[model samples]
Structure formats: structure tokens, C-alpha cells
Target: MTTPNELRLLPWSGSGDKPCYLSTDDPDGYMSRLADSIEAIQLGTASELLEEASEALDSQGTSLDDMRCLVKELTGALRDVYRVAASRGHLLTTSDPREPTY
Candidate 1:
């Protein structure tokens, strides 16, 4: 029997880009470790992409194509990070709207 809290978190999402989780009784198994490894790689790549983007911003000679590629990579990394977080029941929270005073 597997419990929700003991389930393994997958590295990616399911249909419609929804988070997918594994209900494995063995959270310390190979697949779970693999997922963790992949997530680590994704985060690491995202960090590297951010550094490159920053460097690109400082360079006046960066080409449009190179910038576009960097944006695409960063976008993918963000999506992956989001999916992982969402899988772990983590969500983005926005502050409640405050009524404007006339």
C-alpha cells in the first residue's frame, strides 16, 4: 500500500501539462532517484541559462538569434521548474487585490 505523502514525485507533468506523481511505495527506489537527478539537471541548466542571459544583456554585440535561443531555453527551464514544484503540491501565490481609494 502506498500513501500520498510517500509517493514519488515525477520530474515532469501529465496530460494538459498537469503535474504527474508516482504512487510508488518505494520513494527511495531507482525511479525516484532518477527523477530527482533529472530535476537537479533541469535546475542546474536553468541557472546556467540565467547567467548566459545576464552576460548577453551586458554585451552590445549579441545577435537577435542568440538572444532568442537563450529566451527559449530559459522558458523551457522555467516550465520544468514549475511542473516540479506543482507536483510537490507547491503553487504560486498572488497577493489578494486591495480596493483602490478614489
Candidate 2:
């Protein structure tokens, strides 16, 4: 199974295809487009995992420890993705009026 953090581009490998270059040609716009793509996949996978966890928990009944742990793990996976993205500056922050923390 592929880990959430790994980048997979099938049919392409290093040194063959021209690499994706994030240049000063249009930094913010380039980063914004990258961020949008990241958000789409990250949010999509997170949503699916959360839904699966919810169904698993419901089927297993309340007070199930394993289900709770699974939910936490899934949540952590998502948090880590966002944290790394922000650290890499793919996400921008403003301090004026402040936005939703999440």
C-alpha cells in the first residue's frame, strides 16, 4: 500500500521526463496551483478514510478501542500532510484578521 506522504507518478521516472520546475516566473500562482492539487487529493483521501472509519466504528458498536485508535491514526495522517505542506510554504498564512485555524 502506498503511504500518504509518497508521491507516485506512474509511467514517469527521474531523468526521463522534464522535471516539474517551480520557478520565479510566477511563484505565487505556481504555488497556489500546486496547493490546490494537493488539497484536492489530500482532502479526498481524508474524507474517504474518515467515512470508512465511521462505518467501521458503527458496525463494531460504541466503546470499541480499536475503532477509536483507527480514527486517531487517520486524523493524524491528515494533520501531518497539512503540517508538512505548510512547512514547505505550499500554504500561505495571513495574520490580519486571522482565518480559520484549520
Task: Give lDDT tens digits, candidate 1, residues 54-100.
Answer: 99999999999999988999999998887677655531222223645
Model 1 clash count equals 0
Flag clash pairs in model 2. Answer: none
Report the number of the highest-lDDT candidate. 1
Q: lDDT for model 1, on a 0 to 1 scale?
A: 0.75
User: Candidate 1, 55: how far from true, in Å?
Assistant: 0.5
List runs of model 1 lying over 4 Å from the truth: 4-9, 13-19, 90-102
Candidate 2, residue 40: the lDDT equals 65
Every candidate's lDDT? 0.75, 0.53
Please give the range of 10 consecutive residues that has the lowest summed lDDT in model 2: 4-13
